[model samples]
Target: MKSNFKFFLAILSVVFVFTACNKYEEGPMLSVLTKKARLTGDWKVEKRISASGDVQLFQTNEVLKINKSGSFDIFVADSLTRFGTWAFAKEKEYVYFTYKKEGVDNIDEFKIIRLKNKELWMEDTEGVQFNYVPA
Candidate 1:
């Protein structure tokens, strides 16, 4: 009877342990990549607005590649160039990122306006708007 109680307790303990464990993980940084993060692949520029508020449609092939490995790339006129490593900027009201190339030591930041199904929109502080669609 005692052996039976011990076996039952052992099974109960196992069940309790399994049920108590949680699968979700919280990021340590304030700039979190939530489950809804959609900027994870290649994209092509469809529209761009300069600081002058002049809209320009993409004439040549301009592409931006966002990688899961914390890197980004730019393709212009069918020529691929390493943009550099990318990371979320400081915890501001909007989502933004800062990136620096291999040769340049300056980090450029852009504020994201929209990031959803097949589209991405961002702008620099100077109000240069950039819109992208899935490539």
Candidate 2:
């Protein structure tokens, strides 16, 4: 009887330890990828708006590549010279980006897609939306 009880206690201890270990390993409590985060890849500019509320649609195609390193290269039409680094901020359901260009800071606003199927939207700080068709 003494030997049997010790064996049972050992098994129970092992089971308790395994359960505690498994509880610690419960994957990520939540997904870190947001709709704004889905904007991680290369994107094309469908429209451009100025700070003065001017809108310009490019006659030629423009592309922007966002890298995991937080750097982006902007391709204006056929030119491939403009590039900059970007910073991200998370506030509630909104994600904001700050682009540093030629020593000037360009702050932009973006809205996170609450739904998984919706296309990601980028906006200026004032909430002007930029529809980025993912490349």
Candidate 3:
């Protein structure tokens, strides 16, 4: 029947249109070759950028120290504070910033763009960029 053939064609057209569309990406996007060993060290935040491209630079004395023992410390001027427990999710390419803040309950995950011995770069889920360098 002509009507039956028309229905089949319509279905086929819809399928092809969907297949032709670009694939959608969900969740944090990270580099394919992010390894954990490059993350341990003392780093200072040289610059930070928001998703909208706003930038912030830190003072020289502030630093983030990541030891091989699994804890992270943040130092601002003369004050040293515990930032959180840190772990690398090799499969997801995210650094898990796990902590129990006074009122909040959840782990923060930052997608790493590049991690090297001298520099570390990451972006939050909101796309804010944090660039670090050896302190």
lDDT of 3 by residue, 1-135 (tens): 999999999999987876654221221223343345568888898999999999998777888888777888888886886577888785636788777678676687888776766778888889998989998
CA lDDT of 91 in candidate 1? 45
The alpha-carbon deviation from the true structure for residue 107 of candidate 3, after best TM-score superposition, in angstroms, is 1.6
Instruction: Return the top candidate by TM-score.
Output: 3
Clashing pairs in 2: 109-123, 109-124
Off by over 4 Å in 1: 1-36, 92-102
- Per-residue error at 128 for model 2, in Å? 1.8
TM-scores for all candidates: the values are 0.62, 0.50, 0.66
Lowest-sum lDDT 10-residue window in model 2: 21-30
Model 1 per-residue lDDT tens digits across residues 42-118? 88888999988899998657778888777788888778754777776544323333455565576667776665656
Per-residue lDDT of 26 in model 3:
27
Query: What is the full ranking by lDDT, best candidate first?
Result: 3, 1, 2
- Residue 35 displacement in candidate 2 (angstroms): 5.4
* Candidate 2 lDDT score relative to the true structure: 0.57
